[model samples]
Target: MKAAIIGGGVIGGGWAARFLLNGWDVAVFDPDPEAERKIGEVIANARRSLPALYDTALPAEGNLSFHSEMADAVQNANWIQESIPERLDLKHRILGDLSELAPETAVIGSSTSGFKPSELNEKGARAIVAHPFNPVYLLPLIELVGDAGACENAAPVLRSIGMFPLMVRKEIDAHIADRFLEAVWREALWLVKDGIATTEEIDEAIRMGFGIRWAQMGLFETYRIAGGEAGMKHFMAQFGPALKWPWTKLMDVPEFTDELVDLIAGQSDAQSGHMSIRELERLRDDNLVGMMRALKKTGSGAGGVIQRHEADLPKPEAPDLPITGDRKIPVSWTDYNGHMNETHYLEAGSLATDRFMELIGADANYIASGKSYFTIETHVRYLSELHAGNRLTIRTQVLKGEGKKLHLFHFLYGPDDTLAATVETLLLHVDLTTRASSLPDQAVAEKLGAYHQAHAALEQPEGAGRSVGQKA
Candidate 1:
């Protein structure tokens, strides 16, 4: 797939990085001479962040080119994105030309935050609003508004690049999320103007309080829980009267004077001047990853989207050895020493055991039938240290497989071909309902037996039969 980016500003660059990283050839055009350098910086940050969100590596990145002419950029593109300055005239002018130059089948998306589709299409330009959040490569939400058929056609393409396409039922100014954001922003600005709170304090108020809740439960759901056992109606009944109070200046706009601008900018600098923008971006990405992973376990909200996407990603087709877990060590998995934590070796082994079970017909369906493997013993030997971002591969060797017991050994190697760890584990099949040892199903037993026979000629790893003791 190929995507053309017509403006290489921050948001446009982000769109480029997203498509390029997801294996789409990208052609970018911008009048700014420094657009290539600026976009390259964004791509650098994206490379560090996006792949860190997944356990497996993303597809090999697609080709990227800086085009000198708009016509050349859109010549053979599958998708064309317009992220020029948010001026309707500028959009119409460029889009009018784009419609004439680009293929009619190509998706034309506008990253316009304020303009409605009606205004954008007023000049007979068939463009859709595909407004995405900042750091577009990381955040999944993309507000899609336009023709039904066009939006529907773009949905799968957006999903292919790990984005959530929120097709708006109706065309509205500023779309959905930004309307809410503008309200909060207006309130925050007033608070600063009235000297009720500083910029940092206002940020703290959100990040330390409702921001976390909003991430998973969103607004109505969070308040519904706050309503206690009675539900949303009760909560609305209790707090709806407060809406009339003069508590907030939501309807008021603060004067945008030079003094106000300087004051707000000064306060923001004081709040986060210690870190570079790159440093802050990394911090934000790490926090998002941590929170999203926590949500993944519970299968809720944004985390659920990530979990489902990860499932859809095709497993890396390495040669079919029992090598189940192959991935880069995430930054979150490291300790202060910048090395992978001690416990993750066993975690990787556990993942391999699950994969081995699936390969032998002891999958989710089989386990649902009241039979599953339970680890009875495990021994891990640290051969060497592994640092964060190190690519690791696990190779499994089946030692024994019988009626109810299976023994296996896993060897973990780092990028440099050094053996980093070894895990030896023993498992027993059990019936969940009866809480007793169970004979393996015939199909599973046959598969396990074949694997055991295949690995029987290999010598046992030195660490496997060793007991915990000091040599005399």
Candidate 2:
């Protein structure tokens, strides 16, 4: 598929990166002379961060081109995303031009924070408000507003690019998330104006407090959990009355005087001015990757979306070798030495074992039937250091596969084709409920025996039989 981005600002570049990295050819039209440089920078950041969120490799990136004319950009586009500034007139003009050239089936999405669909559709254009948060390549939530059919048509396409599309039932000013964000912005401004907190203090309050909760559990669910056994009703009944208090200036406004602006800017500068914007962006991406990976482990919220998507990702093709894993080392797996931690070797081995189990017919369906392989013993030899961001693969050999016992040997090779680590594992087929070893089914046994026989002639690796002791 081909995507055309009508602007090349931060949000627009992000859209380009998201679609381009997902294997969609992208054409971006922006009048700015520096649009290409800026969009290239955003794509570099996206390349580093977005793919780190998953264990499997993303599809081969699509082609990217910059165009000066709107007609040239949207000529063969399947989706046209308009992320010009917030001005409605400019958006209407761009959409008018886009609608004229774009394919009839093309979905036109406007990244307007405050405008409703009706407001944007005034000139008989069928543009939809497909508002996405900043760093669009990473964040999954997108608020979509438009005709039901248009929104519905865009939903799967958005999801196909690893986005969560929230189609608004009714259009309102600022949509949903931005409305909540606007409320917080107003309150934070009031706090700064009232001398209650500095910019850094307010940021710390959010990051150290509810911000983490909001990532996995949104406002209502977090409050529901806080309500104990009674849930949301009890929590609302207890705290809803506090809404009448003057604790927040939700309805009030703060003057955007030069003095106020300088004060906030000065505080922000003092807080995080040391790092360059690129450095800060990398920091933010690293944190997001870590947090998202944790959420993936638990299968909740945005992390759950990533986990499900990763499961559907196609496994990398292997040659004649019995390949178990083909993925990059996530930054979260690195230790203080700037290389992969010792524990992660075992983690990688465990994942390889999972793949091996699937190869032998002990898949999800089999495991769900109360039978699965349980690793009883594992020994890992770390031959060399493997750093974060390194693409690696695990090669496996079945040493024994009979009765209820399975012995496997795995070799982990780093980016340079050097063996970074080796793992030897012993597993037992067991009934999960009984926790006792059990005979493998005939089909599973046959597959395992085939692998064992195929690998029988291979010589043992150097560290295969070593024990933890000094030679006398």
Candidate 3:
């Protein structure tokens, strides 16, 4: 797929890096003379952060081209993302031009804060408001509002690049998030205006406590959990009365006078005196990636989404026998015969099968407690000689999995789909402590059964393991 990003500053470049790294060609448009340098910085950071989110290798980077003309950037684009300045008239002009040059099949998204879709469509051209945060590649929440069709149309494409599109129920100023942010900003201003805490101190308060929880589970949900064993109602009954406290004026707005702005600027500068903005941004990105990956361990909402996205992400095809890491036959695997050792061929095949099993949720944890499939019998037929680094893959199929036993068949193939060997194994579930034949746990049985059921329709291999009850 191809994506076009307008306004080639930090956000635009982040989007470009994200799409390009994920195998989408990206074209960028920005009139600024410094676009190349600015975008390069963002891409540099993205290159480090995005890949750090995954363990497997990614597809090769896609092509990226800069365009001075908006039309040139958007030509033949499946998606057009606008990240220009937040001025309304500027957006209207760009939207009008995009609507004219881009095809209807292309989804147009705008990164606008506080501008309603209604306001943004003043020229009678509809575009979705897709307000992605700065460092657009890292933080995945995109506020989407416009034609319902537009949101539905763009959600999957947004998801493809590892973003979550959140749709607002109705068009409102600043959309859903900024309202919360504005509230906090107002309160923080009041605090700073009275010198209650410094800018850095406020940030410290957030990062040390609720900020961590909010990363995995957002505010309201966490509060709901805090409501206790009885849930929301119980918590509300216990603490909702604090809402009427005379000590606080909840809705008062402090004036954004010059004094306040200067104070904030001075304090923030002092707080971040050590790091340049670019350095700080890189720091933020590194931290976000770490937190998100840690969250994925728990299968939290966003973490689970990333986990699923990574799951569906395609692994590169392995090169032809002895399929190992990076599709390159390792030097150590070579033997005195100059071909890979025979045992290592089986070892490689086992490794490939093991990797495949882990992909489907079987791993050491599932096997360590003596709840593993023990091979009861095996038949391997070598059809062709394999030299060192001669490529190989195993095409495997389940022959039978009924009650307590399973039958599996594998065909080892080399380059040009040449058949090199075949393996068949009959397996039994056993308890590790007693080493006795045993029935699989219900969950294990169900998983095996599901796999067996899914592959039940395949044709039988040329040779299969003999049943214990039937003689050859």
Root-mean-square deviation of every model: 2.0, 1.9, 10.4
Q: Per-residue lDDT tens digits of candidate 3, residues 393-434?
A: 565666676677877676777767788777777777677788
lDDT of 1 by residue, 1-472 (tens): 8999999998999999999988899999999999999999999888867776676557778999998999999998999999999998999999999989999899999999999989998998999999999889889999999999999999999988888999899888899999999999999988898898999999999999999999999999999998999999999999999999998787789999998899999999999999998799879878887787778778787777777777777665333347666776777888888888878888888988887897789998999999999999998888798976677888888889988999989888897879999888999999988989999999999999988888888887778866667342
Looking at candidate 1, the ten consecutive residues that score lowest on lDDT are 314-323
TM-score of each: 0.94, 0.95, 0.73
lDDT of 3 at 262: 94
What lDDT is reached at residue 354 by model 3?
A: 59
TM-score of 3: 0.73
**Shift in Å, residue 26, candidate 3:** 0.8
Ranking of predictions according to TM-score: 2, 1, 3
Q: Candidate 3's C-alpha lDDT?
A: 0.76
lDDT of each: 0.88, 0.90, 0.76
